[model samples]
Each structure stands twice: as structure tokens, then as C-alpha cells.
Target: METMNVQEHWQNMALDQVPLALAGHEVPWVREARLAAFERFAARGFPTRRDEAWKYTDLSILAKRASFAPDNIPPDAPSEAALNAWMLSRQNVHLMVFVNGHYSPELSYPRNLGPGVQLESLAGMLDENAQLPPELFDAVHEHTVLDALNTAFTTDGAVLRLAPGTRLKTPVYLLYIASGYGVSIYPRNIILAGEGAEATVIEHYMGTLDAHNFTDAVTQLELASGVTIDHCKLVQEGSAAFHIAGVHARQKAGSRFVSHSFALGGKLVRNDITSSLDGPDCDCRMNGLYLLNGRQQADHHTCIDHQAPRGTSRECYRGVLDGASRGVFDGKVIVRPGAEKTDAHQSNRNLLLSRQAEVDTKPQLEIYADEVKCTHGATVGQLDEDSLFYMQSRGIDAETARSLLVYGFLNDVIERVPVSELRSRIVDMVLDRLPQGESIKELL
Candidate 1:
């Protein structure tokens, strides 16, 4: 049997099905844009190691072996017990669930959303002929093939809108679950926060362990002046799954945006986050943590663009790798011309718990303004032996001591999570996944 080239494989499986898949939903300009995006994907194919941005990660195996056929059949609604296990149970919060990229109304709780807030499915909105925002189907940047693919094939996801000056006391949960084997799913989400609005959002992705699934998701956020949003994303897909996700955010004057990302599962994962501070006095903060082991691979790329005067941005990402797993972090902060008084900082840190584990980290700062303050740095190393010894001297065994140290290292980022319930769940999840995790349970 001959192996198909990455470009040939995707062009045969995905590119040809765009038109028919979106047959009835095609408005003239929308259809044209989807076709154009498909053309772009066909021309560029997948990013290779030769590309500078992808130099530290490779997609050859995924492109050749992974499935590209769309999974149109929606899986059964999760049982009540299963839903309870997966949902973030709390008062005043709303939950929306999607199974294999299709909304499951039976499993979602859409009640009690106060005035000035709108929550609905993207597919539902399109079906009802609701006016869709132009940014919903557009690419946030011009440089990626995955974004083009997502734009061409996105079927269903959550859409959220908040009216001006509206403040929600509780967060909104968007849960995506993959159930079948050898399937591909694309989820697209759009969020619009009106002026002076305040809200929190959580996006959670999970899947069955036996499925050989591929998920490509995109999320776009538009924050108006004086708005503040706390956003968090958790990726806990199957260990055999391939996940690629992108988040693009634009902030207006006096707006504030904070992002938290957690990557705990998947065979091959790539996360891309880009934020643009386009108006004066805006601030952005990005933080992430990835736990990988057992031959897994995770790559994260982030870009922060300071386009206006008196803007500020900060980013910190941490990784913990064991067994033969690998990790990559590439972060860049840019201060454009005339963006004086800009303050930006970026850092990437990694912990290797096994001899075979490896990591590649790069932090960059590009400042065009003469009066800007910017700094970037990256570090890759193992846990401190002296600290482990200190714990061991306090009656803790070697394995327990190591686990405690590892948890302490990761807790730095976890502690910054603003939602108390979510933060507690994340802490428990991280401890349970660490090496010899059970031994440190009593200590926690």
C-alpha cells in the first residue's frame, strides 16, 4: 500500500466535501468565503517542521494516518450519571453540552439566563436565519492551514452575547465530548462582550479513551470598551486523539481579558492563542499548564500584539512531562510603533520527570516603540533534588516527596485560576495525574 502525501490525503477526504456539507446554509458571500478558505487549505496543506513557527513540532504521522471523514451522526445523550460526572455543578452557572460537535439539548441546562444575555447554538442560529456576525466565519490571522480547515467545515458550537453593562454573577460552561471511533469533529464558538460587561466562560473538551478521533476547534472573542472577561479552556481528550485548537481575541479601550489553559490528555495536541490589544489602556494576561506522559506530545504557541499606547500584557506557561512525552512552547510579544508606554512580559518553564522526556521552549519580544518595557525568558530543567531531599527528611518517602514537589511546581499556575470551584477541580485533577500521585493524596 502506498502512503498518501499529507496534502493529497486531506484534499481527497476533506476539501471536496465542503460545498455539499454546507449546501442549504450557503448565503452567497458566506459560501464564497468558505470556498476560498478551502482553496487556501488545499494550497498550503499541513504545516511542516520546515516552517519556522512549527519547527519544534511535526505533523507528518497525523496527516498520513489520522481520519478526516466527518462524523455526522450524533451520539446518544449521555446518561444522567455521566452528565453529573462531567458537569461543573454549581449554583447560578449555565451548562451547554455538545456530543461529537452537535448540540444535545436534552443534556443542556439553558434556564435562568438573566436579561441582556443570549446563549444559543451556532447551528441553531444559522438554521433560524438569525443574523450572524461577520467575524464568526472569518480567520483571525492569515498564516495557518488549520484555521482554514476549521472555517470550511465547522458545523456546531456555542454562541454567547452579552448586552452593554450587563454583569453575570455566574460563569457559562461549554462542554464538548467525542464518543465514536475513527471520526473527525470541528467545533466553532463566537463570543461578543458588549461595553462595560463582565462575565466568565469555561470551555472543556473530553473524549472516550478508545476512540481514534481528531478534533479541530476555533473560538473567537470580541471584547468591547470597558469589558472584562475571565476565560478558561481545559483539554482532556482521549490519549489516542489528535486535537488542534485556536483562540483569537480582540480587546477594545479599557478592556481587560484573562486566559487560563490546561492540557492534560491527547496523543498529539497543538494550541494556538493570539490576542490583540487594539485600544488604549487595555490589559491582557495569559497563563497555561500542560501535563503529558506516555509518549504524548503537546505544543502551545501564543502571540500578544500591543497595538495602542499604554497597553500591558503578561504571559506565563508551564509544562510537566514524564515517560517519553515531549512538549513545546513558543510565545511572542510584539509592541507596534507608536505604542509607547507598553509593558509586556513573557516566560516559559518546564519540568522533566523522566530521562527520555524532552521539551523545547522559546520566548520572544519584539518592540518597535522606543519607550516600551518588555522582557522574555525560557527555562527547562528538572525538579530540585535539594527540595526533594528536604521533604524526604521530613518523614516523606522518595516517591511521595517527588509528587509533593511536582504539585507545588504546578500549583503556581493553578492558584491563579479565578473561579473557586473550577480551581479546586483543577488542583485535584493535576494531583491525580502526577507520577506516583496516589502517594501524595494524604499530604494534600
Candidate 2:
């Protein structure tokens, strides 16, 4: 008997499983694309610690686990109370819910979309017409194995499109819930904002506590000239779950793209986000916060490509790691040649509450243009003892003082969230999870 390597195991899994996964969709191009993606995955294999991009994180545990396939048998839908609780009781929002990568019409609210706005499931679109544009799968770079796996196995996800000059007052919500045990789900989403259109979208991923699950998600967004989009992604999966997600956006001239990401759950999680400024005068802002404790590990990687002149980008990410958890932040900004007058700034800050907690942070800038202004920086440190002592001297308990200081450290990034309700929700979630959170809540 011969032992198989991790890459060989996955390659065999892709070969054996992808055809069965494509049972429902008879689209020729979709099949071709999936096969192509599987080939890419087999060629590149999974990244190792030796790989520069994956230096701080390791996926050996995930790869060694038994191969997981899509859960064809749908589990029971979550109760209304669970849905409402996870949604934070947000009202007047267009909601689309998925359970195990299958769209649930009963749990979704698809009404009142008004004119020039379209929201539906990508799988539904494929069923209606198999001739969708091939560019939908061209968003991410072809070198990533996980992305290729997602492309090969993705069944359904949210699809939103806005016509030119349309404005949607209500935000769109995409909620993904994992219910079954030891299931793998691939979700692929696409968002298109036409010229002069404006809208907001929020994506939420969650699962039952203690359930073992894996979620591989990919999202691609395109903003035409003069469009404005506010995007938020929240990951609150089970403590025993593994999650990997990627978000890619392309911005046209004068378009504005703002993103806020929150990672608060999962035993192991990785988030990759990239934004390309393809047209001049485009603006992009990326903000993220991660909270980890116990044995959890989280990694965030971001890239901003300034491909045109006069583009501007700003990024700020903060993390709080406690217990024996670990965190990683890698941010890169590239100003391509001929992209003059570009302005980009990136910063990553981490706070460790426990001595055993670890964090690796890297902020980099590559400039090929002469007249560009770019700056990058990273900081990792424990909570400020001076502030903690000052609060303790003011009669505050030590635990409460520490919580206050942590909240204060994160308040700056939380305040930058554009949606007031979401910001408040984040604040409540953070405070509820903090050590001695109840006492600090009274102070707030």
C-alpha cells in the first residue's frame, strides 16, 4: 500500500467528484470552465507554508481530513427566530437566504426590488439561460487552488445587477447558513453596479455551533463609471468550522467601492480581498476587523491595484487575539507603470491580550510610477498598560478596565463603518464577547 500526498488526494477528489457535482447544470460553457478550473487546481495544488503568500498560515489539517462533497440532501431550514437573530432584525432590506449552497425561497425576501434592479440566484440564472458571460469566472487570478475548487464546485449564490442611474435605498442581504454536519458548500456571487448606480450589499455566513463544516465562497463585483457601492461581509460560522472566502472588485472611472469585513468565528478562517482600479479617478476603501479566542486562527490578505492614473485607495485592518489563537494580516498595494498621481495608504494593527497569542502582519507597497504617493505600515502590540492602569486607578476593576481599553482600541475602526445600524450591531457583538463584557457595556 502506498500513501498519497495531500495534493494527490485533492486532485483525485476533484477528478472523481466534479462531474457528479455538475449533474443539474447542462450548460456546455459552465462544464468547460469547471473542467478548466479543476485542471488549474491540479496543476497549482494547495499552497504550503513555504509559499510566500501562505507563510503565516497552514492548511495541512484541512487537506488531511477526509474529502468533503456538496451535501445533496438539504437539511432542515433554520427557524424564523434563528434567521431574525442572525440578521440582527434588519428591516426593509432585500434578503436572499441559502442553506447548504441551495437557495431557499421561503426564507428569502425578493419583493419590492423596484425598476432596473435584478436580484436572483446564480443557479437560477443558469437554469434559465446557459449562455451567461464567461467573464464571470475571470475575476480572480488563476493561480489559487481554493478559488479553482470553488469555481469547479460552486452551485448557487446571490446575483445582483443594477441598471444605469438606478439607486436602491434598501440594502441587499445575502445570508448563507450551514446546517448539516461535515458538509462542504461552495458559494459564488456576482454584483454589477451600472453607471451612476448606487447600492449597498451585505453578506453573512453562519453555522450551528459545534457542527463541522467547510465553506468556500467567491464573490466578484464590477462597478461601472460613476457607480457607488457599499459592501459588507460578516463571517460567524461554527467554532469547529473551516472557512475560506475571496472577494474581487473592479472599479471604473469615478466609481467608489467601500468594503467592511468582520471575522469573528470559525476554528480556522482565511479571507482574501482584492480591488482593481481600472479607470482613472476611482476611489476604494477597505476596512476589516477580526476577533479570535480559544484555539481559533484567522488570516486576512488584501491587495489594491492602481492600474490607472489618479486612483486613490485607503485600507485599515485591526485584530484582537486572545487565548492561544493566532492572526495574520498581509496587505499589498501596487501602483502600476503609467499610473501617475496615485494615492494609496495601508495600515494594519493588532492587539494581543494573552502572552501565548500570536500575530504576523505585513504591509507592503510597490510603486512603478514616478509621481505616486504611497505609504504602508503595520503594528503588533499588547494592550496599553498606561491606559489600563489609569482606568484601574479610577476604581474600575482590572478586567473591566482591560475590556474598556480593547473597546476603545477598536472603536476607531468601528466608527468608520458607513451603516449606522451595522456599526451598532458590531459594537454589541464585540462587547458581548469581550472578557468582563457586561461591566464594560455599562460604561459604554
Candidate 3:
């Protein structure tokens, strides 16, 4: 992962046609905002390993290449059979589909939504309502180099709003499908749930199983007082693709936000999550799982900031690495000076399945308040050979027993997912993708 060449590529790349990407659109304001972002992206260029946050996962491979710019994609309707074959049909949530970062209304469905739920594509919203929030266009995050990059080039995504006193019985699915070679696209999304609102949203990122491409995405969520949100992400990219994503959340008094991130694809992947409790009684939960094999890389960075009194945050992330793959986890929790009675905890655990596999994990706690409780821990190791041997002695073959034990070890985190359909599917999916899993099961 070289750095000098990527910086040079960003410096020399031309942005002459950036305007054409959004030309003659119905909304002048949104177009103007993207132009400004592109300018910012051009000015900052790509981030290097010298940066503290990104030191572990190098961006040289991505920086040296020129990703495809955003353009209008002709809508490709998903046939009726395709819809029926959707893996997550059991969820019964509102569904929205985007192809190559462009929203495809034809493939989306506005399901049996509650009274106060509003789901629409960003482009359509901008065209319909001229008074969209101006702050949305503002650069909310510039601390990391990748944040700046995502802000500068993101094109099409969806915005979801749940009005006050609204409670949704079903989840909302915002799915993105990337299909093509040498393609790069960005999806920037914002979600706002008003006071006392309750909703569940799942953002799914799936591409052609073998496509060569890159996806850089940003998602911001705001939970108002007394609001509760359950957000989940499932990413499955190809072996030749790269994935970079960030999730930023802010919560108000008496609000609760629970998020789960599952990463299981791409040649290289990274997910950065940040949460802030700005008022009393605010609570947050951040849970994640990453599975890697071959020479793949998976990284997760998280921060939980307690800004007000009596707020609590709990986070746990786990990873399984096989072959020559590597895994990275860096988590931090902070309690502000005036944040009394703040309770925060974080943990990161990893399992290495091969001699060449590696994992780097670090957890940090920063507390400025006197009456606060905070703890952090990290561990990297291999499976329990004793347990495997015990099972092998009880009429089970060594390989079959090993797979069974590994699956059981991961179930601790996988079972925490609230959605039953997703939980079952993820468990099966992970097992199916593990090394020699299919052959071991057949042998048994």
C-alpha cells in the first residue's frame, strides 16, 4: 500500500466534468452543494497512513486509481422474480433500491408504512421540496481524510424521517447494488427521527459477487428526545472491490440508539462509527462483526462521547480471520467534564484461524468527569484447541468439531441482533463462507 502515488493521482486528476454529472437538474441548490463538495475534495486530496485514524488501513491502493464519477444511470427494473427472490423478504420493511449510486424508483416499493413515516430518494426530495435543510450540505465532519473525501464526491442516496409519536412495526430497507467493473460510487444518507418516534432501519450494501469496484459512503443519523432507533448494516462486496463507510449518530435527552454492523466482503474494508450523547438519560449500543479470509483486510474504528450527565454507552465488536487475512479494531469512549454519572463500556475480541492471519485491536477510555464509570478491553487469539479435542473424542471428526466450535463461538455476538430473519441468515451466510465449511458439513 504505497502512499506517494495515490496522493499524486488525486493531485493530478481533473474535475472539469464534475458539473456535467449534475447538469440541468430540477434542483439547483443540491447541484450547487455537490459542486462545493467536489471543490473541497479536490483541495484536500487523499489521506495518507501518516494520519492517526487511518494508520492501520492503508489507502494507497485506492488513492492511485481514478474511481468513476457519478452519472445518471438508466433505470433497470428488477423483474418480479427478482423481487420474490430477495433474501430479506421476511422482514416486510419499506424497501428502496439504488443501482450504482443512482436511486431506481422502479425497483423500490413503499410498503405498509406507518402514518408518520416519510421515505424518498434524495434527488426526488430536493426536487419536490425547495426548503430542505441547508446544514445537510455543510461539511459536518472533516477530522479524518476519508470523511472529507466522502463528503466531496457523494452523489445519490435516500433520506428517512419519522414524525413525533410515530412507532413503526416494520423495518425500512435501503439497499444499494453495485454492478460493473472499474466502477466507483458514493451514497450519502441522512436520517431524522423526531421526539418519541420509534423505527428500525437496515442499510444493505450488496454488489455483483465478483465485480471490481469501490464504494465510499457516509450516513448521518439524528435521534431527537425520547426517540429510539435500531440501525443495522450488512456489507457484501466482491473480492476485487474496496469498501469504506462511516456512521455518525447524535442523540438527545432520554433517547436510545442501537446499531449493528456486519462486514463480510471486499478485498479491503473499513467502517468508522461515532456517537454522541448530548443530553441526560441518553443511551447507545454499538455492536459489530467482521469475517475475513484470504489476504483481505477489515477495520473498525469507533468513538462514543458522553457529553451530558447520566448517559450510558455500550459497545462490543468481534472479528474472525482465516487464511492470510488481517483484522483491525480501534475503539474509544470519552466522558466530558460535566458528564456526571456517565457509564460507558467497550470491548474488542478477535479469533485467528491460520498461522499467517493477524489482528490488531486497541480500546481506549478517556474520562474527564469524577463520577463516571468507563472500561475498555481488547483481545486477539485463536480457537480453543481443548474444546475441539474434547468434541473429537466424542465421536466427532476433528474438522467437523472445529467448525462447530467456531460457529458456536461467533454466535454470542450474532445472537444479539434483534431481527430474527437477519440473524438466521447471517449465521448461515457466515458459516457457508468459512474455509472448508461446506466440505466439513458434508463429511459429517
Point to the candidate with the largest lDDT. 2
Report the lDDT tens digits of candidate 2 across residue range 229-263. 98999888999999988888999999999988899
Residue range 369-400, candidate 1, lDDT tens digits: 87898988888999898998898889888888
Please give the CA lDDT of all the candidate structures.
0.83, 0.84, 0.78
State model 1's lDDT.
Answer: 0.83
- For model 3, residues 108-209, the per-residue Cα lDDT tens digits are 776777588888777666556544575666666543555555555666787888899899878888888877676787787888889999988888887665
TM-score of each: 0.94, 0.95, 0.92
Regions of candidate 3 where Cα sits further than 4 Å from its true position: 1-12, 16-20, 23-29, 75-86, 435-444
Candidate 2 residue pairs in backbone clash: none
Per lDDT, what order, best first? 2, 1, 3
Clash pairs of candidate 3? Answer: none
